[model samples]
Each structure stands twice: as C-alpha cells, then as structure tokens.
Target: MHAISVRRVRRSLPRAALALVLAALGAALGPGAAPAAAAGHAEECSTEAGPYQKTVERHLKLTVDGVQSAADCAAIRTLQTRHGMEPATGRAGPETWRIVQYERAVADPSALTGCPHGTRLIVCVDLHRQLLWVWDGDHVATGPVPIRTGKSGYATRTGEHRIYERVEKQWSELYEGPMPFSQFFDGGQALHASYRNIWEEPGSHGCVNLRYDDAKRLWQGLRLNDPVYVWGTRGP
Candidate 1:
C-alpha cells in the first residue's frame, strides 16, 4: 500500500507541473493567447474586419461589428458585389481588402502623396496600391481608376514624366497589338486601354493599362506637358 501511494503521487506531480507551466505561458502571452484553434479563429475575424471596419461605417453607411456578426459580414458581401469583386461570399480576404484600401485612399486627400507639390493637373499612379488618380490642383478630376502596370521583369519607371505624344488609336510595333488612346510618357511605354481585365493579376508588359472608360476619361482630361508621376513598387 505504501509503495502504491508513492507511485500515484509521482504521477500527479508531472500533471501539476504541466498545468503550472501552461498557466505561466498564458499569462505571458496575454488573453489573446488562447488555444491554437481559438487563436486562429480570432485572427481570421480580425483580418476580415480590419480593412472594411471604417469603410463600412463611413462609406457603405452600414454598421461595423468588427466582422464578428452575421449582419456585418452580409454588408461587406453586398459592398463587394457592388464593386464587382468575385466570390462575394461575405468572407473578407486579401483581394477584397485591397479594393477597400484603394477606395479609402482615393477618398482621402492626404493619401495622394505621390503627386508632386505645386503641380496641377497631374496623373498620379501608385504602383504599390495599384491605383491611378487625376489630380486637378486640390480636386480629383476623374480617377481612382484601377490600373495594371508593368509586371516583374519589366517594372514601370518611377519619378516624374510628361505626356510627349498622344494617339487616339496607336499600334504597338513591338508587340503588334492595339493600344487605344495611347499616351506616351516613357519611350515605347504608354498609358492606354487594354481589353483584358485590368483587375486580373500579372499586369502589363511595361505600359500602364486602364479600363476603356477610364482611358477615355484620362485622354480627355490630360494634356501635353502635364506631369505624370508613378511611384512605389508592386508589393508581393
């Protein structure tokens, strides 16, 4: 009997020590340091909520519940649908978040940091954000248009440039393709309309491709010698 009691105490000691260690770890990591599954779920909800929280409250004119409730998710789905985003299944992911970020940046005047100071009627393209905006002094004339810039090997050049030539319908001699409303700013590279889906990944060969309507708008607004600023790098 004495031997059996001693063995039981030894077994219980390990269990008690494990519990104490777990408690200490939990305390160090804080309340958010839940079990793995619980922590993962929390992180997912947080990622889904981050980009659209303010957008939902301010622009979508809906309630923001940190994406914790069904109603909040539904609202986000509706917004995504309106914006033409695919798989609008009330689940916010990277692509959906990107669109939200772009919209928010367009609406915020302070976000136009790429536009040079004292320059009026400028074409600003943020490669990292993948957005284009036509700035007329303090006002935005016509953009926040989604654009596809040069892909990996042929990254678009940054810094200030000017539209040196404009052609309503230009043919790409190098690629033997149609480049409508071509506005050349950097060598053969131009800003033009591409029939391919601009939102689709792995963008242009070196030119900045805009949607048909946006290209038309830009063609009408931009003039020769107007500053065209392209900045930032395409993010991974």
Candidate 2:
C-alpha cells in the first residue's frame, strides 16, 4: 500500500476557524448522532435533455418521453442537487442516473445485494456503482451515500479489510492537505471526506472519498476493527 494523497480545492475558512468549527461540532453532538447538512442555495435547473433523459424520467415517474421538459428538469434537478451531484443539471447524465440507482437501492435492503450483513458493522464499498453503505449486521447504520474511489491505475483495493485507525482530522504531509474523518482501513488508503467535489472526474489516489457530512457521520457511526468489504471494478 502507498500513502494516499488527495488533491482538493481548499475552502475559504482559515485553518484555525475550521478547527474551531469541528471542535464545536464534536461537543454539540453525541457519538453516532448525524450532523445537519450545510445550508446551500439550490442550483439552477437544467432544461436540456440529458443523455439518459428517458431513464431519469421513468424513474422520477414522469412521462417516459425522453424529452427534457420543465417539470422533468425540476424533478431531476432536485434529486441531483440533494444528492450533491456536480452541476445539479436537471439533464439526465451518467452520474445522475447512477445516483438514482443508489437511491432506489438504498430503500430496498435486498438491493444491497453483496457485502455480508451480520450483527457487526460492515462497511460496503461498491466501486462499480461509486457508492458506499454501512451495514450493521442486518441494519444499515449509515451510508448508501455517493462516493468517489481511486481513479485509473490507482484503483481502491478490493477484498475484506478492517479499519485500524481513525483521525477526526488528519494531515497529509506528502500532499499538504487535510483528510478529515479519516478511517484508515488499508495502509494509507482510508475512507475520508474530500475537500473537492466527490463527483468530479478522475477520483482519488486510492482512498474512498465521501462528502464532508457523510464522512463525519461515518466517523461517528463506525469504530476501529469494523470490517470493510470492497468489490467490483469502477465503470468507465
């Protein structure tokens, strides 16, 4: 395993202020409590037909007309924006459709399909689908959230592993960046929050990158020694 260094766009907050914010968050919430989502303005809805326009329309229970109408765009855009998809375009794109699939699957336990479920917490990473979900035996403690895994040749390793370390805030000396809510399960590769948009192309070095809120919640929901199961090749 190699040291995983993530390239990200730094936020505006100063380092000290960011630290204080995180400290305040820890004090305000008990362990395993979910964090409230950060406030944001809704993205503009897309009017152009997405590549998978029909797929999105059918799933959103709209007329399967393959055309991107105002209503279709609004529904699709809302779903995309809520899931933190980049662009938040109402047009049905590959990433948008993938998120739709995950959302549908998350509602149905059987849709989880793989990654053994038992009494212990098991983190399941579906590289092909670009999603991660935490399974507490039969219960899903957290996740089924969107994620960006290693890109190109630096694919995230697949197999059974266990989290060995966790750091609420970890600094990467090699890359000179922050890896927040880092749960190191394999060598330097961990499940952590990426400062960059997880939907952006060309993914991480080898870590499983989640949204900030998702990673923070994962930190609270998971503990050391929790099993992690990763499988499937990332789709093109």
Residue-level lDDT of model 2, residues 1-236, one tens digit each, is: 23655655454564346556766775678665524432243456777898889887888899998998889988998888787666676878878778777788877767786687777778999988888998887888886888888888888999999999888888877667789999998878899998777766777878898889999999988889989999998864
Runs of candidate 1 with Cα error greater than 4 angstroms are 1-76, 87-94
* Candidate 2 residue pairs that clash: 118-137
> Model 1: per-residue lDDT, tens digit, 1-236?
00000000011233335556667777788997844433212112222564446545445666654553566666667766677654455555545555766788767867767666454788888888788888787788877877878877878888899998888977665565678888888766778887665555556777888888999889988888878889999753
In Å, residue 136's CA in model 2 sits off its true spot by 1.9
Q: Each prediction's TM-score against the native? A: 0.64, 0.76
Among the numbered candidates, top lDDT falls to 2
Residue 135 of model 1: what lDDT? 78
